[model samples]
Target: MRVALLSDCYLPRLGGIEVQVHDLARSLRQAGHEAVVVTATQGPDEPIDDVPVERLAIPLPGGVPVNPLAPPKVRRLLLDGGFDVAHVHMGVVSPFAMDSMRVALGVGIPTVATWHCVLAHAAPLVDAAGYVERWADRGAELTAVSQVAAAPLRRMSGGAPVSVLPNGIDVARWSPGPRPEASTGSLRVVTAMRLALRKRPLDLVKVVARARELAPGADLRLEILGEGPQRRRLEAWSARHGAQEWLSLPGRVTREELHRRYLASDVYVAPAELEAFGIAALEARASGLPVVGPRRSGITEFVADGRDGLLVDDDEQFAQALARLATDADLRDRLGAYARSTPVRQDWGEVVAQTVQAYGRARA
Candidate 1:
């Protein structure tokens, strides 16, 4: 199969959707299908990691991904490229991806559109626009990153089937060979997320602060990885709370570095309640760290409460759970052991197979 993977985001930028779309294209090629990335994200047409990239980007201030003049170029490509399928990846507000979807369908190419964001915050605007419902009516196959993300799409589609096409990870690559024993008695808690407001990065600091107050002598330490707009706010919060000694905000690090940190850490905390699918949490779990996160979010797909890790309903409960895990080595070990033993179902092989199935449905 010759597939064109379209997205408003791609390599040279790092985020959930960008990373997943790139990985999905690579996975397809590895499975013996020819996959090319057609992105509006500002980057060269050169192949990234041996997979071809087609950029329809228009220069804009702040390097915005939207390309107003991309429709004709996208239609021409789909018409002339002989693409077997056009797989469109969308975030909550992806105008470029949306435009690509329309162009692909207008050119009569088989198209699969996958949503990578939770729609709770954008439901009203999306509902009012009715683009998704109309797309469903026009036979554009729809999928989402997780069941949590699919719920609103299903509702808006007015009974169209919304499948769950999850994000993929390299499980073996992430698996820690042997966790290094902690030389210091201090417990390390780690989290990786773009320091954005929606991700609730500051909430992690508050949770840790409250946990320290709850377990005054537990020697708990936190390391938040990843850089974003919330860095200054987090720094000021840490300073005001006198948490510099216990809290460390080391900006984004390489994946290998993250795996090393996970191996050295005791637990991973995901503070976002609206997380569609916690990829960072999954990576930590793959590296043999127990995950602590909300029960209602997509983290529940893999992090089973009381089995894989502990789940909390509110900030107070999150703090209490962190304190309990910090104080109880046995519980931490148990959860981490389970996390290591149980392989995630979102491995690239499984995800590639699912992608093939979605393509089949789109073609049908």
Candidate 2:
């Protein structure tokens, strides 16, 4: 089967959806299917992992990098490329993805639309848009990364099923290794995420500060990997709370470096409450690191409370979890051991099989 994985962004742009799109294409090929990536984000016309990437020249309005004129080209691709299925990954408000779905459906091509974001506050708008898109392509298969992300779309789907397809990670690549020895006596907490408002990087700093206050003499250090618009603000917050000395922002690193960082750290923390699927938390667990984060988000799918990791409901609870993990090495070791033993559903082959099943349903 030939599949076209459509997205608003692709390689050269580091994002969860972009990575998933690329991985999905590679997995599809590994499953004996031809796959291609059709994205609006500009990049060289080169094959990544042997899967061809088609980067369209799209317009950016008000600095929002999306192609307004993507529908025509998408329709042309569907009609000309002889693709067996069109799998469109939808962003929060992606015109290109939506347009691609519309064009694929209009041209009588099987289409699968995967929702990858949890629009917590802007759900009404998303519902409205989803309603219009569903009306436009009622036969298209709809999916979400998690149940929380599927709620609004489910309402828009009337009585139709909304499949839950969580993101997959390369388990072997993220497997546990010999943990790097900690140089400092302090507990090392690591978090990798974009420093965006939704990720709450500033709140993480505050949580680290609170943990210090709770632990008193127990030393704790935080290393945040990744960069975004909130870098300056997060730095300022760390300085204001006298946490600059203990907190280090190393920006972004390669995948190998990320795995090394996870092995080097004592614990992993995810502050994002709106994560559709927490890939970083999954990687942390695969790396033998116990995870600490809110109980309400998608990370709960993998991180079992008190087993693989600790789940909290509020900032104070988050701080207390950190404090406990920082002060107690035995508990950390036990949790970390359990985290390593626990198996997460991240096999790329399984993900591809499920995706092919969705494509078959779409074609039916």
Candidate 3:
């Protein structure tokens, strides 16, 4: 089967959608399918990792990944590519992806549109716009990365069913490893995410600080990975909380480094309430670390409360959970062992199968 992945973002612009779309294409090709990425992201048109990429990027200032004038080009590409399915990946505000979906449907191609971001707050506006209804009327199949992401879509889709098409991980790549003995005697807690307000990096820092206070005798150190605009604010907040020594924001690191850190860390924290899918937390879970995350987030898809990790209701509960894990070695060990021993169902093989199922539905 030949599939064209339509997205507003792609490789060289590191993001959730970009990475997932790239990995999906790679996995599709590995599964003996011809997959090509059709994106608006400004990058080299060269094939990445043997997967073909067609960039319809408009060179705006700051390399923004949006091309208002790419409709004609996108139409031509789809009409000529002989693609069996035009799989469109969308975020909350993906004009290019929506346009591509319209073009694909207009040309009578099977199109599967997947939403990668949470749309709770924007559902009303999107429903009012009636795009989802129109797409449904035109025989387009819709899906989302998780149940949390699918909820809003279900409402705005005008009774059109929205299925879950989760992001996948390389299980063996992040499988449990022998954790190195701690030399500092501090509980190494880690989180990997862009330091943005939506991710609530500062909020996580505060929760960790409160956890330290709740378990003063238990030494806890937090190292946040990834970089964004909130670095200065997070640093200043940590200083104000007098947590500079224990809380470290190491900015962005390579994927291998992240995997290594997860192996070394004792626990993972993901405090984002609006998280559509917790990819970082999944990686940590795959690496045998117990996770502490919001109960209402997409992390619930994997991290079971008191099983793989502790799910909290609010910041106070989040801090309490962290403190409990820090002081109670038995609980932490049990959860970590469970997390490590269990395999995540959202592996590439299962995800590819699910993608094929969606494509089949779109073709029908």
Candidate 4:
């Protein structure tokens, strides 16, 4: 089955969705299926790693690197050959999705779309009523990354069932490995996320600062991973909040380096007020580290409070949870030990099988 995977974000952009799309497409190809990626082009002669890429015409605000448009030739090819499946990622009623849908439906192609971003975060981009009507009209099988992602997506489905599929990690690539790096005397707690406002990287800063005051002797050091526009602001805040001495800002890590960092760190902390699903936290858990994150939204589906990890509500509770993990090595070890035991959505192999199955379904 020839399957086309479409996403707004891809490699070099650096985000959870982008990473997920790349991994999923790669897994699909490895499984012997033709999985091609259709993404918004960054610009002329953009270096897109090794993936096969086609450019779209979507405009970006301030010429930001987002290309969410579709070219006619790609559309003609998708329609002419009748792609078994058009698996779209995180597309709402946006122009890109609308254009893609025109080609999909014109060729009598069955489409499956995965909801990646949390609905609340996507409110500004999607037209709720128009989106639902369009989604229902488009006639596509819908799947969401988690139950948290499923809720808001339910509205768009009308009466269609939304499959709760998880975004998977390449277990072999993202597992706990090496002898692990020592955080010196500090019980290392790391937060790996883009420095975006919605990600609330500042929340990590605030929580780390508070933890320093509450649990000074714990020798806590927080590694803020990933890069974005807010790097300077986060660094400045770390200084002003007195977490500078121990807080390290290591911007952006590759897949290999990220997994290594996970192994090195004792705990993974995410202060995102809104998280579609905590992929970073999952990677951390896969690397045998307990996670500290919020209770509400998609994160709860993976993070079981007091079990694999601790889930809190606000900044105050986030600080408390980190402090608890920092002070109790035995408990952190216990949680980390069990953290890896939690089942994930797609173990590369399963992702392959399910994707092929979706292609079959699309054909039928």
State how far residue 335 of model 4 sits from its true place (Å).
0.2
Q: After superposition, how far is residue 249 of candidate 4 from its true place, in Å?
A: 0.7
TM-score of each: 0.96, 0.94, 0.97, 0.87
Top-lDDT candidate index: 3
lDDT for position 169 in model 1: 96
Ranking by lDDT: 3, 1, 2, 4
Please give the lDDT score at residue 60 for candidate 2: 62
* lDDT for residue 40 in candidate 3, whole number 0-100: 91
lDDT of 3 by residue, 65-97 (tens): 999999999999999999999999999999899
The lDDT of each candidate is 0.89, 0.85, 0.90, 0.72
Q: Which has the better TM-score: candidate 2, or candidate 3?
A: 3
For candidate 2, give the lDDT.
0.85
Q: What is the lDDT of residue 223 in candidate 2?
A: 97
In model 4, which regions exceed 4 Å deviation?
A: 43-50, 58-74, 91-94, 121-128, 178-186, 340-345
Encode model 4's per-residue lDDT on 270-351: one tens digit a residue: 7886677788877777776778887885777667888888888788888887787777777776787786655555477876
- Assess candidate 1 and give its TM-score to the true structure: 0.96
Any idea what lDDT model 4 has?
Answer: 0.72
> Of 3 and 4, which scores higher on TM-score?
3
